[model samples]
Target: MVLGWRRRKNNNHKGVKQNVEVIVPNHFMCPISLDLMKDPVTLSTGITYDRQNVEKWFDEGNCTCPVTYQIVRNLDMTPNHSLRILTQDWCVENKQHGVERIPTPRIPVSRFDVAELLIQVKASARGLDQYGCLELVHKMKRLGNEMERNKRCIVENGAPGALASAFDAFANDSIERNVNVLEEILSALNWMFPLKLEAHKYLGSKASLTCMVWFLKQQGLSGKEKSIVTLKELLSFGDEKHVEALSEIEGVCELLVEFINKRISPTITKASMRVVWYLVSSSSPCSDKMKLAFVELDLVSSLLDILIESEKSLCEKALAIFESLCSIEQGREKGYSNYLTVPLLVKKILRVSALTTEYCISSIWKMCKLGEKDDEKRVIVEAFHVGAFQKILLVLQVGCGDKIKEKATELLKLMNPYRAHLECIDSDYKNLKRSF
Candidate 1:
């Protein structure tokens, strides 16, 4: 593409150097990426684009040609062989200008090929040797990694359910001998997002839950994070018995708490938090006991640490769990014991999203009371010191739901009596606009 060159002198006349000016022919560039096309393919709209760029555009729910602005009659693309040859020739001619010839792209794998592979995988899961099964899964992963089309093909052919059953099959065998294959399957499954699996076979049983807990215990295992993510997905379709079974599992709660305390990547953090929230927020009686168990494992302090620097979504999840915990006496006691609890809630009052702000206010409300007793005075002083009054007043000014307004009003009443003893100004209350 850089067939032109120029010459210029150094600033101090140290040397004369050739400066190559790179120019790509208009037809050689993809309209979407504005770069020389590596794999030029023509759409049905008679527009040429880089294969990867256009494929990505289609994957994002686009039904019209980006350049033509017309409905795409055909999703298939025809290779622009002439333009590709010209581009490759230009690259070779401009070798000194740092242009590299693009390699020929591979054709996408067919659904029939993926279907055949899934059949082999399912067969291997039933009776193949451990090494054989592992190799097949690695092949699937390689195919998945090679191209997006192959991954979609594999998933559309039911890779998720097959893989889940395969994992369950291996779990039923000698786990110590089949751990390697299990980890490989988990690694492959991790790349396949939005998994659609038969929940009853994957996680509805006690044995499956036990197998998952074993994976969670493998501290040095490569698939621990993936296992948690998979577990969270399964819980979406799980039921009350499943929740109870998780609580009955030995050390499951502790492992979950330890996982949270590790502060791994935010994705894994949110996944693990969601799993806990699902369990603790359930209507089952074990939910209360699980809340107490988490509190005992120092879950409150871990959540506080998450709240201090987490993003909006993860912060909302952490706050949801925090709110669930505060619904109990032991949880509130543990929260009050942590020095950072109230101040962090006050800091996040109006700063995060409305849902997050509601969680914060609800949590703070649960931890405080209205009486003028010594204990109440202590909590009121803490809230006043942290500027809770001003934040709640701001919440009212900014306009909130009736429930939030009611809580804010009650919070204001709690702190108003102690304002004289605290740092609040008279104008802070006098200049207030009551939107409620």
Candidate 2:
């Protein structure tokens, strides 16, 4: 019921001249909320609901009209400025009643304005004095949060390219040898890092990627964490060329291994593992290079240490990376050098979670399942050295997932024939879990 239907306390109402209850108009109410619409917007279904309500629906992954329950082919919500004007005006005229006036909504930044800002930023970044560029970038970051529309506008307008070039300029500029300033630039870039498409192009710039890799090697954990996360984001979308570029960056694998060795934070360890996984998993030219890098850097030792020291989730990630490191001959030698790896896998198998069993089984299986009968005999002997043979017996007894059980059973059969030829003790297996 509109206030237009209010009782005639006096003849002040211009058109309404009836004695009735003061009520709000039904059209003013949001269909979803059953409350008066504030900042009304029209959906593609031609239904007008409160802007906040409709947007909340969309953000929650609902794709249909709240009223019609029909698929919203175009999810765009156009602001019902005219209806909003009427709603606000009605509230103002009904001040004698308890209705509060709806305040005017702030306008979101337009796409054209965002593009114009990007143009200004590109021009300022190219200039010798980057003060203007930094200032403009700060503005862009602020504008980016103002609306999702602005975020899309920023990416579409080539904000990633502009900001990436600016990042390189900041790093190499002699006039501004300020790490804090570079951090600010990187931090601002974080806003778009998670959302931007073709992001590897930004990260692949020569001086810039090198600077980030070197930054990862430095002491500050905060800086390294941010760099790792940004690197992971880029690698998530990285293609063959980016992988090669990453492989070419000196000290990248070494620093990643260093971060894992430090074991300061679960987040840091996971980030490092993700980088290693992406490089190895996205194999092309980088697979062999990355596997060799893992061996050359002696990551096997650090990753092994993490298996013992970290929590369940972190241990799972470490195990995963270790699995990759041992997949190749060089990687296998690196693991063979680390006496703790086989023992650690034996200790952790079926102990962590079903998810980790795959990693542990694969690592242990890769260590033992050999092409040469001589290598098989060698690894089986090494397995006994670290009590791996006994642990395999325990996995058979404990009995985990079918795949894990099968893998353990296979290794057991291989070692069974050698059991009579070689020597082993039951007590070594019992205490092996406590070795780490």
For candidate 1, write residues 357-376 as lDDT tens digits.
88888887777752226645
Clashes of each: 0, 2
- TM-score versus the correct structure, for each prediction: 0.76, 0.73
Q: Cα deviation of 435 in candidate 1 (Å)?
A: 40
- lDDT of all predictions: 0.79, 0.73
With a 3 Å backbone cut-off (N, CA, C), the pairs that clash in candidate 1 are none
What lDDT score is found at residue 365 in candidate 1? 77
Top candidate by lDDT = 1
Once fitted onto the true fold, the runs of candidate 1 whose alpha carbons sit more than 4 angstroms away are 1-37, 40-49, 60-74, 77-99, 197-205, 219-221, 236-242, 262-270, 301-318, 337-340, 351-356, 369-378, 420-436
lDDT of 2 by residue, 1-436 (tens): 3433344555676764656465788888898887878778888879999877887888899989988999999866788999889888888887776568988775656667877886887676567356777678778878777767677667776777767766776666642364655665677677676645534565666666777786777638778777777778777775676677877987788777877776677667788888888888676766877888887887777777767656887888878877877778887777776666666776676678866777887787787774356666777776665556677677667667787778778877777776666766423233333233
Model 1: weakest 10-residue lDDT segment is 426-435
Candidate 2 lDDT score relative to the true structure? 0.73
